[model samples]
Target: MNARGFTEEQEEFAAAVRQFAAKECGTREQRAVLTDDNREQHHDSIYAKIAASGYLGVSIPEEYGGSGGGILEQVILFEELWRGMVPVHGAGTSHTVAGVYKRYASEQQKKDVLGAICAGEVMSISISEPGAGSDAAAISCKAVRDGDVYRINGQKTWCSDAQFASKILLVARTGRGHRPHDGLTMFEIPTSTPGLDIRPIRTMGGGAEVNDLFFTDVEVPVTAVVGEEGGAWRQVMAGLNGERIVCAAQGLGMAQRSFDDLLGYLREREQFGAPIGSFQAVRHRVADLAIEIEASRALTYDTARRVAANEGAPEELVRATSMAKVKVTETAKRVALEGVQLMGGYGYTLEFDMERHLRLAIPATIYAGTNEIQRDIISSTFGLRPGRS
Candidate 1:
């Protein structure tokens, strides 16, 4: 590791990404045009530029036309982009789906799926049905095995970027087993598959990125199954844990940005004929926030280091990741809220980026397993159970 616990190569790569962000969407106006003045969550023109920069393949292996980097590089990309205010909403999901394909896909599947992703096409995960948000094992989306294919019929909600993605990583129940988690399978299905519908869900965040995906008699070849047919529960669980660091990286960046904006406001905004930061109470609050942001940075990078050192994380790392996810995300939300309160009406306006930060931070706690779930995981790892120590 080099400066700030990143390797020298990673540091250089982050500088390059920062420069790319500065050149592309460095200003709020540039980002606004890319996102159509915040009405859109994704823009093809900007995303095409990002793909051309090869940042899309930062964590993907080189064999499949990627940059052959690892988790750390992906974290840098995510953190720097968010810090620079580059709104590539699809990058997170696409990066995650590549990991799935890398881990479970057959050679041909990797060549096809990962190739498309590296080539600038995006991917979305199809989990979280109407009844299966937290309890993913309760998935009711059924994919029954037909003669030569599987016929899928169900609706998946809260699927991000499904409308614009070239592929979707779907989790559908194929059978029943001892536990609800068993007998589920993962599938890679093209977005253009028959009997599929994508409907945009208007959210308060002012983006049409999330959607509901409907499948009626959608048929996929039996070969589309990823990993074992009846063993996707384990696959999905590990995958979620693995992606926790990604969220932490993103949250840390957001929190830092919020604090930076707040600090500048406190220094410049005058009240009682002096800068508000000159007041002891305001100074104390700002100091507290600074400490919290620093703590979040430490926790996130320390967890990343442990994960990198382990080659792969042990089962215990689940709790570590859960802790990092909750701390970073909750801190990010708090910073945004505090920034809004301190900046008064200015923070709430579209003129400042604080409201956008708040919009993005609010969902981090709820999605990808809620903060409550993260705490539960941490507690359970401490041996908490029904009538147990």
Candidate 2:
């Protein structure tokens, strides 16, 4: 009955997730306590709870200790979690890492890494460096191969959950090639590896969820390379489509939460002896947001289905997923800001969760890829190049 046409099983799954969220981590006060002290321990405990419920592997394969589901299932899982005001930083990145492993990792690597991820062990990816954020191909992290091992030496920025991660999916330059992206390679390295330094980056939202990672002579076995040694460009690009879809799902969930909170406030807060929702201006704005949210949801679901149907078609998926990312994230940012505005001074304070929602939504537009990059991807799909157009 929902806009996305969820099947009976999907509906039941979503309901189960909602029930878990309500019973296990409900209320702003409860979640605040969980996030306030010993963040790494709290995050581990929360992830363990989620893993114990068998929800962590919704999109993973059964052979790898997953639930044998597809991308749409993952989108549903993330959307429901965000709607429940759950912090999805670990879960989202973990899923992306799992997806990459499933596709490009060696058989042994898949068995080890994917199973650990499904069991709630966090594994972060290091792609963005000081010199490269959106331009992943420009990564300067060097991994010099020496007989049976590779010595990694470089720095990575914006590596979320690096402090608590057991391993990191690292991208580095193995050798100089014909193109900027030609020399790249991927590896799975343990966080405890020697010469790997992790430093937390505090945000305005009062959380240190991201970090800067410095790798100096961090050695890994030759078998650690993912996919082809010099073919990481295709692997990275392929993974981005899935990442975008997940980001879109996060945006959709946050937007839905903001809309719900705004509507609740409008219905409860009275002005001139009537609910503020009775005001035509307020009603119209809510209506507009609702329309945009529905549109974003539709696009996101459609793109997920497309990705599921076309597994290896990276070029085709790029356009749809980029559009989904742009629409859903922009909608989330807009909805969160408006929710704060609608609630007046109460929304600005930490007492109300609206401000927190805004903090989370603003970053979605930047991470995964900026909205501007998404627009460019969409245009490129239509044969429009930067100079030619």
Candidate 3:
């Protein structure tokens, strides 16, 4: 293994991905042009190029025309992509969909969807609704069974990539179960469905990466149900391992990039006729950030390895992944903020990548099951319930 603990082949793959990003969207000007002034984080052309390189679905199997790598390879790809600041927004959701399809989708659906995804198509999962963010099971989006299809009608907010996604893995309530997580089912609906309306939600990031999807009598065939009629909760729960790992990997790469930029600035930026980094106070603060970044990496990779080793250990993975998600994302936010503070006036300007990094990092803690929710998951693993039992 290399110093970072990756095998020779993995290291070579990482280097190749880094070079790809450097050539595609490495510089600020190049990224600006590709992303249209930071407005399109998931630029179509750039994503198509990444697909052409066979890296977008690196975690998928070779039978699906993917790179035939595993979760670890996906982690490496995410780190290299974000470290080089490649603005591809579709990788995380694509891999998550790939995993879900592998386990639950029908044979025909798998053959079609997996091949499409590996061929550069984008897909998104809609679990959060207007009233359900942390309480995902609270989704009220209703899908009623008809003769040959399910007529869906509800509003789903914070649906990332819905505006551009080819298919949406939708979670809708079908009936009431003994518990909250029951009576739910997943549907694979095409974006072109007549009654499905997608409204973009613009954030400070200005990428329109997320959207509010409204389904008005949207009809999809019975075959659209992913795994079982009322087994959607199990399907979603089973995919959490890779989902949380994806978040942690993303934060790891972003934190490293922010720290690198800050250190470079400190070394060259002069104050009191000497480099600002030479000051004890500045040095100490930078040292703390460096430590935090390293700690985040260790936690992320360790949890990843453990999850791989104990593939089916759901309970252990729940605790480990929740902790990793919280730490990595929180640390990413802190590191980017610190970079901004260290750079002072220059950091906030659009000319620097720090501002963009901050934009990306700020939401890391909110999405993929918010950091607060993650903490609750971690604590629950210890037999400690947050609210009164």
| Local accuracy of candidate 2 as per-residue lDDT tens digits, 1-389 | 56558888999999999887787668876687677721321256777888988899888899989999999999999998888876546888888888889889999999999899889899898889988998887899999999999999999999988888899999899888778788999998899999999999988656888899999899999999989998888887778889999999989999999999889999999989999899998999999999999999999998998998995456678988999999999999999999998889888887777888888889899888899989988898888988844
Which tens-of-lDDT digit does each residue in 1-389 have in candidate 1?
A: 76597778888999998898889887888888887787776777777888888889987889998999877787788888877777778888988788888888899999988877888898999889999898887899999998889999999999989989998999999999988688899998899999999999988668888999999999999998987898788777767655898999899888988998889888998998999889998789888989998998888877877776763446578888899899999999999999998889998999988998899889988877899988888898877955746
Model 2 misplaced stretches (Cα beyond 4 Å): 1-3, 37-42, 311-314
lDDT (CA) per prediction? 0.86, 0.87, 0.89
By lDDT, the best candidate is 3
Predicted model with the maximum TM-score: 3
Candidate 2, residue 172: CA error in Å?
Answer: 0.5
How many backbone clashes are present in model 2?
A: 0
Model 3 local distance difference test score: 0.89
How would you encode candidate 3's per-residue C-alpha lDDT over 180-294 as one tens digit per residue? 8899999999999999999999897767889999999999999999999899999998989889998999999999999999898899999889999999988999999989989
